[model samples]
Target: MTNEFSNSENLFPAYNQHEVVEKLETGFKKLNDKFINLLEENQRIKQHNKNLQEENQDILRINLELNEKNQEISRNNLESNKKYQEISRNNSNLIRINNDLKVKLQARDKQIEKLQNDLNLEKQKNKEIQRLEVISQNLEKNLKILEVDEIDINTINVFKENNEQTNCNINKNPTTALNYSKGLDDIRIVVGLDFGVTYSGFAYCHVIDENMHTNDNWPWGVTGQFRTNTVLRYDDEFNNVLYWGARALKNRKQNSEPVKLFNLYLGDLPDNLKPKLPIDYKKAITDYLREIGMFIKEKICHLDGFDYFEDVLLVLTIPAEYSEMDKVIMRQCVYNADLIKDRDSEKLQFTTESKATALNCTFMFVDCGKYTTNLTTRKLVRNDPLHIDKVTVQIRDFYGSRLINEEFIKFLRERLGTCTIDLLKENNYEGLQYMVKKFYRRITRSFTGDDKKFNYELDILYEAPILLRHVSEEIKEIMGEIIEIKYNDIKKMFDPIVDRIIRLIHIQLLNNKENCSTIFLTGDFCVSKYLQNRIKEEFSHQVNNISVPALPEVAVVRGAVIYGLSTILYGTEFDGLKLVISSRLLKFTYGIQYNWKSSDDLTHNGKNCKFKTLVKRDTEITPDQTFSFNFKPGSKQISESFAIYYTQKYNIWYCDEPGVKRLGILNIDLSDVQLDSRSINFGLTFGQYEIIASARNERNRQEHMATFCYPDDDF
Candidate 1:
C-alpha cells in the first residue's frame, strides 16, 4: 500500500508540474507580445530622433555658410575703410594746398608791388628822358619871337597850361573832396535867371547844403555862373560836363574866349545857319537850356533817385516884344532838352522876371527890363484880370549895361590894336572873360552898389574886356531903347493914349466881359515904373492875379514849363507863334532926288522911279517856312512898309486876349517860292495899311511914300 501511495504522489506531482508549465507558457506568450509592441514603439522613437538630428545638422551647415559670408563681408568692409581713409587724407592735403596757394598769392602780390614801384621809377626816368628830348626838339620853337598878337596869346596860353598841369600834378597828394563827384551820389542845384533883350542876369543859389565842397560850380552840389550877357564856351577835356553862362560872357576879348554876341541875331537868324555842335549861337543856347534842365533835376533829387531824370522844371524868359517866331525858338529849347532824359521837355509858368523881386517884397511890381518897363497889378486872386490899358508900358533904346559895355569896348580899343575886333570874332573869348570878371566887380559896385568880390580869377576877368563890352552894349542898347523910349514917349506923346488905354482897361476889367474871370499879365516888359502908377490907379478896384516868383529872369521859362505841362497832360489851347515883320520899303519916291550908284539897289537904276507894293500888304506863311518880305532901310530914295504873319499851328503866345488874335504882319506879296518842291501852300492877308510922305535935308517938295503894315478896311 505504501508503494502504491508513493506512486500516486509522484503522478500528482508530475501533473502539477505540467499545469505550472502550461500557465508559464501562457504568461510567456503575453509578455512576448507586450515586448514586441514596446520594441516597435521604441523603433519609431529612434527614427524620429534620427530625423531631428538630420534637420539640426542641416541648420548648422546653413549657419556655417552664413558665418563664412559674414566674415568675407567684414573683410571687404575693412578694405573699404582703408580706402576711405586714404581719400580723406587726400582731401586734407588738397585743403592744405589751397591755403598754401593763398599764401603764395600774397607773396606774389608783395613782389608785384615791389615790381610796380621799380617800374614806376623806371617810367619816371623814361619820362625825364622824353621831356629832355622834347625840350631839345622845341628849342627852336620856343625861341622868343616878337610879341605879335596871336603869337603872344599862344605863348601865354601854353605857359598857363603848363603851369596848371604842374600845379595839378603837385597838388594831387590829397585833394579836398569837392562837390563835383560826391561819393557818386546825385547833386542838387538852383539856378536863377534874369533874362533880357540885351543883358541877362543870373544867380545860382543853394537851398540845401547837404555836404562840404571846394568846387564853386558844384559847391554844396549847386553851381551858379552869370554875367550881364549871353556867351558860351566848352572844352571836352576839362569842362565836358561843365557849363557856364555869365562866365562865358566875361571872356569875349583877346580872341581867346569861346563866346559870341548872338543876341541881335536871335530875331534874324539865317535860315540855314543853325550850328550843329562844338560851339555856335544855337548850340550855345541849346546847351545852356539843357544844363538848366539838369540843374532843375538836381535840385529835386530828393523827389527821385536821379538815376534817370524824372520831373524837371525848366524856366525861360523872353521880352514882351518877342515875336511869335521867337517864342517858337524859345519853346524848342525845352523840347530839345527832353532828349537828355529820353523824355519830352515841358515848360512851366511864364511870368516877368522882374515880378519875382516884387513878389518877394511888395504888393506891386515896377521893373525896367532891358527892352521895356513893366508894372504888375495884383489883388491876390489868381483868376483876376490884368488891365492892359491902365498900365503905362514903356520902352527905350538905351540901357546902363549897354553903356558899360560900350565904355569897356572903348577902353579895349584904346588899349588894344586895330585887329581887336577881328581877334574877338575868331572865337577867342579869354580876353573878354578876363575883362568881364574885372568889370563885373566894378559894374556891380557902380550899378547895384554891391562891392562884394565875385568868385573868379583876376587874369581871367580882364583879357577881352573889349569883346565883352561889345556884347554888353548890344544887349543894353536893344533893351535900354525899349525901356527909355517907353518912359519918355509915354509921358510926352502918349498921355492922351494912356488915358484912352485906361478907359479901355476900365471897360475890360469893370465889365468883366467875354466870360473872362482872370487877367494875368506876364513878360519882361511887365514892370515899368510908369506902368506901376497907372495900373495902381486903374486896377485898384479890380481883381487880379499878379505873380512874381523868386527867380524873375526865369519867369517866362517857368511859365513856359507850366504851359508845356498843360498841353502835354491835358487838352489845352495855346496861342501859336507870332511872326514879326519889321519895317521894309518897296517904294520910296518921297525923301529926296539922289544920284544913282551901281552899288546901292535903290540908286542902281538911273531914272527917278516911283515904287509900289506888289503884294499889296496881304500874305500868310506856315510855321515851317520863314516869310521874307522885301524892305529897305530908310533912305533918300526908297519907300518902305511893315508886314509879317504867323499861322495858327504856330501859335505859342501865352496871352489871354479874347479878341486879340496872334496876328502876323506882312508888307509885300510872296510869289510861288520853292520849298523842297514836294508840297505847295499859299494865302493872303491885309489890315490897316498906311501911307506917309516925308522929305530929306535941303529938299522943299515932300517926297511921296507909304509906311504901314495894316490895311484901312475894317473888313
Candidate 2:
C-alpha cells in the first residue's frame, strides 16, 4: 500500500505539480493581463488630460479676445471725451479773441476819426497861410525898389553879411547842371587896387580866362599874365604913364612933374580927382570888388572848373592893420561873386595867397600879384624873457618897410643931381612924395655917372670912395634946387604907430617869472640884425629870441603843406621822418621848451628835459636837407617823433609883416610820425639857415654849405 500509495502520491504529486504549475501559469497570466490593462487605462487617462488641456487653452484664448474688445471700447470712450474737451476750450479762446478784436476795432475807428479832423484843421490853416501870402504879394506890388545902388548898399554893408553857419550837408555825387547860353562867352578880368598911405600900387589878376571853357586840347594854362604899377605925373594938362616894374626902374628923367591923385588919403577928396559919381573910401572898395567880379564871370567861367575857383574864392590882401569893420566889408564883397553852394557844383574853399603858395592842395592860384616888403630878423636870444613862454615877443626893432623907404630916400638925396629928385620937393608934402615916387620908378637907368666896371685892382677900391664923392657932386648939379621943410610933422605922423608897436613888444616881455625862458621869434621880422640889436639893447636879460630866417616870412604856409601831407597820409608811416643827433656841430644848444605839449603832458613815461618839435614853423631850411647836432645826454629833442603835424583845413598860413606886424606860433604834435626801425634818423635844423649842415669835426670842415631859397606860395 505504501508503494502504491507512494506511486499514487507521486502521480498525485505530478498532477498536483501540474495543477500547481497551471495555477502558477494562470496567476502569472492574470498579473500580466492586469499590468497590460493598467497600462492601457493610464494611456487613456493621459489622452483625457491632453483633451482637457487643449479645451482650457481654447477657453483662455476666447477670454483674452473678449478682454481685448472691452479695452478697445473703453479707449474709444476716452478719445471721445478728450475730443469734446478740446472743442470746448477752443470755443472759449475764440470767444475771448473776438471780444478783444471788437475793442481794438472801436479804438481804431475813434483814432481814424480824430486824424481826419486834425487833417482838416491843418488844411484850413494852410488855406489861411495862402490867403496871407496873397495879401503880402498885393502889398509888394506897390513898393518901390528904393533906387538902391552900390554906394548905399556898401554904406550899410556890415549889416548885410551872412555870418550864418556854412552849410555842410553833402552827397556823394550829383548830376551835371544845365549849360549856360546867356550873354557873350568872353571872360573878363580886373586887378585889385592896394592903396597905401604913401604909395598906391595896383595889382591886376585875370578876371576871366580866355580859354576857360575851351576844349582841353592845349595845356598852355594861359598865354601869359600881365602885372603893372601905375605911377603917373602931370605934363601940361596931360598925364604921362611912367615905367612899371623893371621898365619904371630903368627910366627916371621923364617922370618929375607933380599931380593931384598921389597919396592914398582915404578920408580926403582931391581937387583934380573925379569918378563917375561921389564915392566914399569903403564905396570904392566895393566898386572895385564888383568890377572884378563882373570881369571874372565874363572871362573865367567859360571852362568847367576854371570859373569855379574864381567865383567861389575871391582872394584879396589887406594890410594886417586893417580895421575890424573893413574886414567885414571885405568878407561880404568876396561873397558878392554869388558863391553860395552850387546846386550842381562843389563848395569852394576860401584861402589866402600864403596858403596857395604851400601847394598843399591841387588848387589854381594867382600869385606874384601884389607884393609887400619882406621882413628880416636875427632873433635876439637873451637868457630870459620873463618866466612864461612869451613865444612871440619881438626882441628887437628890425629893418622894416619904413627902413626900406628911408634907404630909398637917402639914396635919392645923395644922387639928386642925376636922378632929378629935387623937382619932387613941391609945397605939398604928398605932392612931393608923389612926384618923387614917379621919378624914382624909372630911375634904375639913372645910375649913369660913368660907373667903372670890372676893376680887378685892389688899390682902385681905396680911390673908389673919392670917385663916388665926385659922382655925387656931379649928380647934385643935374637935379633942381631943393627947399627943406620942417620934418617934424612927418616924424610925428609915424611915431604913434611905431610907439604902439613898441608897447606891444613891451607887454610881451612882461611874463614876470624869474625863470630862464626864451622868446622864440617865428615870423618874418626875426631876420633883421637891427631887431636883434634892439631887443638886446632894450629888453636885455628879459627876452631871448629864436628865428627861422626866410622861413618866418612863410612859416605858416610851409606848415600848411605839412598839414596837407599829414591829412592825405594819415595813419601811414610816410608822413614823417625822425633823427638822432649823430655828431656834434654845436655843444650846449639852447632851446625854448613849450609847456605841456609833448610826451611830458600826455605820455605815460614822461621826462622833464625833453619836448617835441617840428620843422614847418617857417623856420628857414633848405629842400633835400640833411644835418646833425648834439644834445646833452640828458637833454631832449622830440621823444615821440615830431617830424610832421597835420591839420583839418589849411592847417597853417604864412603872412608878411612888411612893417611891425609880425607875430604868431606853429602847432606840432606826435601823431605825424612812426618809427621805421629800432634806430632813428634825424634831420637836424638849427637857427635861421638857407641850408642846414653837419660834420664829424667842425674844425676839419672848411667849406660851409649854402642853399638858395625862394618865397613860399600860400594856398
Candidate 2 per-residue lDDT over residues 653-674, each given as its tens digit? 2121111111122111111123
Residue 685 shift from truth in candidate 1, angstroms: 6.1
Clash statistics: count for each candidate: 110, 51
TM-score of each: 0.33, 0.27
Q: Which whole-number lDDT from 0 to 100 does residue 564 have in model 2?
A: 25
Off by over 4 Å in 2: 1-279, 283-325, 335-400, 403-504, 511-529, 532-545, 549-715
Q: What lDDT score goes with residue 221 in model 1? A: 36
Best lDDT among the predictions, by candidate number: 1
